[model samples]
Target: MTKKAYSKLLATATTTAIVASAFAPAASADSKDFSDVSTRYADAVSFLADKGAEGFPDGTFGTHLSIKRVDAAVLIAKVLELDTENAPASGFKDVPARAVGAVNALKEAEIAYGKNSSTFDPDSHVTRGEIALWIERAFQLEGSVEVPFEDVNNRYKDAISMMVANDITQGLTETEFGVSALAKRGDFAIFLHKAYQAMVEQSDFLLTVMHTNDTHGNIQDIAKRATAIEHVRSENPEALLLDAGDVFSGTLYFNEFLGQADLEFMNYLGYDAMTFGNHEFDLGASADGHKALADFIKGAEFPFVSANVDFTKDSTFDGLQNFEVSEDPADGEIYNGIVKEVDGEKVGIFGLTTEETPFISSTGEVQFQDYIERATEMVDKFENQGINKIIALTHLGYDDSLQYDNDLELAKQVDGIDVIVGGHSHTTLDEPVLNEDGEEPTVLVQTGEYGKALGTLDVTFDENGVLTGYAGELIKVSDLEADPVVADMLKPYTEQIEAIKTQSIGKEAAVVLDGVRENVRTKETNLGNLITDGMLAKAKTINPDTVIALQNGGGIRESIDKGDITMGEILTVMPFGNSLGIMELTGAEIIEALEHSVSAAPTASGAFLQVSGLNFTYDSSKPAGERVQTVKVQDGSDLVDIDENASYFVATNTFTAKGGDNYDVFKKAYEDGRLSEPGYVDFEMFAEYLKGLEKIEPTVENRIVDLNAAE
Candidate 1:
């Protein structure tokens, strides 16, 4: 028979068996006429009589009597409505022809086995432990819960545990599982009854998770997000709302109010949990190191999960964090992990910040541990506590080039994580990505950056906590109506931000400055030239030896219209709060860094460089590491070829100087104390440079030339 047809039959028979055991024996029923049956066994005897079950032909259910293996097989086969007439041969010499088909059918279904290679042992009484294993296998029961029965051996522990978890049986006593005791007919009836009921009620468990990441303090559409969340919760009230961090930087909201404005709306919307993104620690280098972060945490309405981040060394977070998973999590506290019960199922959630945070952001004394090791520990802890459903709320980028970390690597290396809510790369996944290389599948999802969209994932799991099916999508927040309360609360913040948007910086662009993502990341643009020139000029002021400047194309966020530039436009272009740094590197090291800049040429890479005070040419046809043709540095009045062993001072953003975007050469210099950060924020420097410019005219001057491009 087909599996689907058989499953349908089993479900039907399971419900029938449980129904037969629930009701007391009816006085007028002809099936209740068995003389040897007591009230406890009467219902089962009546059910057997109506179904014409085997071993009850003498009008006696034989209450307290042990059932033979063959008779037990016949009863189960009849209840499951298996085709006994067409069953295959048992291949046993001692089996009776009348019961051979029933025993063979049970064997074919993998619910029963022979005592020896050739012996059916049809006459042997079935043991309670044996029955438990058979029932568990027949129905495909799963899960384990602590049980009081101590007599169950290791061999039968899994089956017994599954039975107890399903409420199918409780054993003979509080301390004894009766593994070796004979299965009495009266007791088997109740066991079968509960198993039947459990089977009848079994269906795939459905869970809905709504998530956001890299919001970057863009709360302009938070009201719409609230409406979207309400709509999703209207369908599934138990749906969890999660954030993957980076809500502390970018945009005017962060600069003015720190993270408190975002936190207010987050609390109002009822965020279940949050994890730290690299940008959340942006203020760690300030005089009030991590004080803003601490206040953000203290004002939050939900608990925070951070398995790999250690805030113990930073007194700003003292007494606010616990180092273990919390079963009863409190608001405004941090934990290594948290257990949340949704619709009677326990879901374990833990957080992982990028290990690169120390170099990329101002983490100060807040140490970060290895992601893989900490993730494994969290998984083990949750599993030990009987939690099978797990989620890793992470700021590790999705499919990031960092092999040591990333959502893809985490899913492949970790064993039990079922879902990953990811951020940090600003990836927009239209549908959830699945990594099935491990023992079980993991669903990785992220919404695009800047609060433009809300992501939703609807997943289904079997009784074993195995992901069976899923459907996910990104909902455009702009399409949704703003929630009235959230809209009202946003008025004060928007008014303040509006005032900041209109104030001019007393400079007009002579022409449209090209900072388009496609233009800036692929090749040099006028805006890139202007920005790098500004960096070079500012660095020279700090250290006269700073002769070369480089800016990552990713930092140029928006374009400038050919008109009076406002503070808002400049902040929009360079919103990451990255500061300036001067790095002392050998000429050979400068050449090596330039080679990496064009490695993904023809394809846009965020690591691509826009330079000033120096010019370079590369052949894109050559292999990535061998692409550079020549590099020259400004030497007084002339451009000269760089000497491999000579040292040169190069100006770049602190992010690049500290090895952001996989710049190993620059990172080495930063680590060796060859880098000095004067701490001038990028936008502030750009504003100053624009004011000093004669006429705001900027042009591409072939500073970065790719040889393979057609003339």
Candidate 2:
């Protein structure tokens, strides 16, 4: 017998029987009235009868009769919940008119096949081993477990293994599966019921989420993003379009329109929701406070979800903030979590912003709560609402800022989150990261920065809302044709940005400024030197006592080409609009900060510092936090060794002065009234310094020497 054909036949029969039984009136009387039905088969008969399954041709259920292949096909079809009403011809002359639909539906699903091209042998009784294969394939069951049945052979081993793993059956006996025995109506009912229960309980659910993160106001590809969104929606119409934040800063576009430009495209693309990224609060300390951020939130066509970010302190968000989870969330509002009903299933989505936001961005009074605590609370709140499918939309880095929080730690520590859409570290997860170490598995994914790619994730969940399988990948945005409507919508913004890009900053570079990722993040480069020198020079005009300047390598986004630098190039390099800050710190704190800076040396760290007015030597062989060997500060003309107890003034961006990039010492000093923000934007200051110099020729002068070098 062909096990494949048998399984499909059984599946079809099971389904048809269920549909018939479902509509069947309470068995002539109650199922208990059937004296011919055994206690074991009585419940099964009642279940079928209650659902409207007719008894065997004779009035009473023929419990002891061998169930025919035609009967099994109908039964399994009901079990699989397959549509049988419009099924085509079964191609078997012997098949009865009533069994034709079930058989054809089974064939269409590739769950069952005829005995031959033209013969279904519909009257043949299905065997125990045959039903096993049918149940396995019909339900798409998977797993490997030992089967002790002696009668089961290699051909049926995989099917039996899955059956055993799922506890679908225990065999005809402890050591026997009765593989060759013909299936009786009574026993088949019990097996079919179990299969039906499995179908109901472990049904596969498909969820597609199209996500992007750290777009950083790079709407140049918004049209392509729209195309990518539509492409995915064509395949998965119900796919959720989500952004993991950092849509606030970058490029000349953000400089001109703030976040309004990005918001327009996001609205047109129909984003489902967004979370708060650190850069979203970059303007918090501005004269107007968070008015821009408030406007951005107000202008959003979709709601925002961030459990840990408290906008309560800022009255600007008074009407927008909703501190509790919402079942019927409205657009243009904020919620701790929201219940989204997708195809009759409830999906819970919450958001988390990194707690380091205050230290990294000018968050003003918008407080950040502990991510783990808020996440746990959100999960509990969702579970209370009977929502088991939970998605944590977060702007926390994938593996960054470990001193505070990250997605990996969240997945391992949290219990219920099924998916994590992440950002901040700008990690490109070509494949979803699976973390099953927690009570339930969690899938983490992110798209890299600058709107270069769109991330797509297809996940499968069981009926119980447990993540079972996932496929995630980054779709290159440049490859897709731009959507005409979005392209038209983006033209005005692009035009304004293009005009800005062509406008020169009144300065020229004598040499190519090296600010490539590999070079700047690992070692000092000409651009790093130039940027830091500008920071020092700009700081001195405000505070002449400032002796050192530092800039994080990660902040230096791009290199300046050898020519007259335009506003676009300047903005591209220093896109965050970070302001200069002068901080008073003890020599020990500065030394400690330097140690933290080079800690990830050999492996480029975003926290790596590029400096001016100072020189430091670190031993890479030494462990992190202990790598610094010597530190020198320029005192008028001579470089003097740093005194651990002495105090010194340093110039850097406000982000670093407030302890961004795990610089806790700087945060302490900022909190202790030792840092002053001068309100000069980094790019503007660089432009000023460049214009003053007329032309630039900066080079690395051993400002930072690593003791351990392969050469």
Candidate 3:
């Protein structure tokens, strides 16, 4: 028989006279009646009755009937009308061979799966928790309901929350739940009936605030993200979208197009809010970074907020609201946080970024304050103004122990902050982390970085602005259906990226693999050697005396994977938009910088250099500057020892020229205005230079052998 015909046959047999008799016992007396069932559930029996689900022959509704695994599968298949054409093969030895097809069908529908080892215990009694999970899987329900269960920890945590969120099951007693216990037939019926009603009356008034962080100019997956958001929003009408920042920098897209296209795309998607990320200042804190921010803000219909950033001194972000307070029509007053009525309940959202932004952000002109201090002040201000339901949208990292305090710390320290919507550090919180404060649980959530996932928190608040409860999940974008509108928005960029993908660079006779793991930091790789050689070669055109070029290993983002390397791939490998800079430094200063690089060997920092036209020996056991005992320069015929007092021409990137890589010695060299011929060394230009050489091969030889290796 064809698959559809087979499914129809199974459904007919399962609901036929014999099967109907078996199920009739469940609706008979001696069946349990669920006392806690909501009033809406009265209509549930009628709905089912209209569909010909009658009470058993005993005149007793067997509402407390123990559901078997096979029966559970059948119910789910019947409810979803799932096609079983490509179902997973049932490998359960205990399941009756005749019942295997039903189990496979349920698995194909994604409504059921074995706990482990592919064993679907077909005869095992289904528990209340299992039923709850199956109901949730069959229908995607997003709302917060009261589950007054106590003892429902870990194993059934998600299931219980889902049951509550969908109004399927309440606790056994007033405040207790035996999640693992088998549910009575009447109670199960009531639960399923309530869930069925919820599915029918699923509110369109629900507003989902889906968010992501640390995009870092990765526009390639924009359509994928847009599709996922659209799928979520289509399920709920009042969906408000937001981004957690770090949307610019990191990739060639930002370097080539700046933030204009990214901002325009975010605007097109109707993003509700965006907080500032440290990398937003990659272009510098002056007019460059602020100008981008101004352009993005001007084009965006929504607000961009940061309560901790004191932009009073900055001219560019003068009019933007740092802290906005407004009255929520559904609830009461709200401050700093945005007030939106979702499912007829008002929610308040505020935002904060890491205080370390000043140090890590390329914007040297802007300053950041203590995050907790600023956040607490904002909370107090909002609370005093009678706004109680608060959500702090934080960009701080998730870890919040006393030693590594961050957003979770902010959640714990501050009072009246209900939830902390967070980003940065790219943490994927599967479930909301509950703060240990004891007074009220603070829900902390963060979606993993790169637009790979969306964080959702479905919450419910009492009329008094107190969080009665909530349910949350990190929806993986890969699992969602793509939004066509978002796909169209990103089509132009996708076309450009696709056009560049296959374009050939100069052919390599031999492989020049990125020996990043082994030599990029502690020493030099042939790849790094080639790059620095090119930088020095380009630098020498202006100053022939330049003997050495130093490139920080961190600037080289990707390795040259084996194959016919293309120009686009090379560009991706070195996407940072840094330029070459030549400077004159005393031999002592060069030695000082080398020592700094060697000292970092213990910590394994990327600031360690891959050098060309020079070699150095260091004793890491010695402290900092004293580590480098010897330095040499090749002078055509011989390797000459460096004289500390002799001035030498050096080449490095502009990031290092400004005393980056902990090279304070260069700061003085910069102060003396000895820096010359500072021009942009597009990494692509270096790649092109490599292409011209054809058959280029580079390897990792021990350029910086540890003298202390034996020890």
Residue 104, model 2, lDDT:
89
Regions more than 4 Å wrong, model 3: 1-43, 46-208, 285-289, 327-336, 400-405, 498-524, 528-567, 571-711
Best-first order by lDDT:
1, 2, 3
* Clashes found in each candidate (C-alpha, N, C closer than 3 A): 0, 31, 18
- Per residue, candidate 3 scores C-alpha lDDT tens digits across 510-610 of 77567465457766677788788788877776567888898887787767766677767677667665656677888888888888788866566678888
Instruction: Please write out the lDDT profile of model 1 over residues 495-604, one tens digit for every residue.
Output: 99899888888989989999999889989899999999999998887678889999999999999999999998998899776767788899999999999999999789
Candidate closer to the true structure by TM-score (higher is better), 2 or 3:
2
- Residue 226, model 3, lDDT: 70
> Candidate 2 — what's its lDDT?
0.81
Runs off by more than 4 Å, candidate 2: 1-202, 504-528, 534-565, 568-613, 616-711
Alpha carbon lDDT of each predicted model: 0.83, 0.81, 0.64
Score residue 699 of candidate 2 by CA lDDT. Answer: 82
The numbered model that scores best in lDDT is: 1
TM-scores, in order shown?
A: 0.57, 0.59, 0.53
For candidate 3, the 10 contiguous residues with the lowest summed lDDT are: 13-22
Question: Candidate 2 versus the native: TM-score?
Answer: 0.59
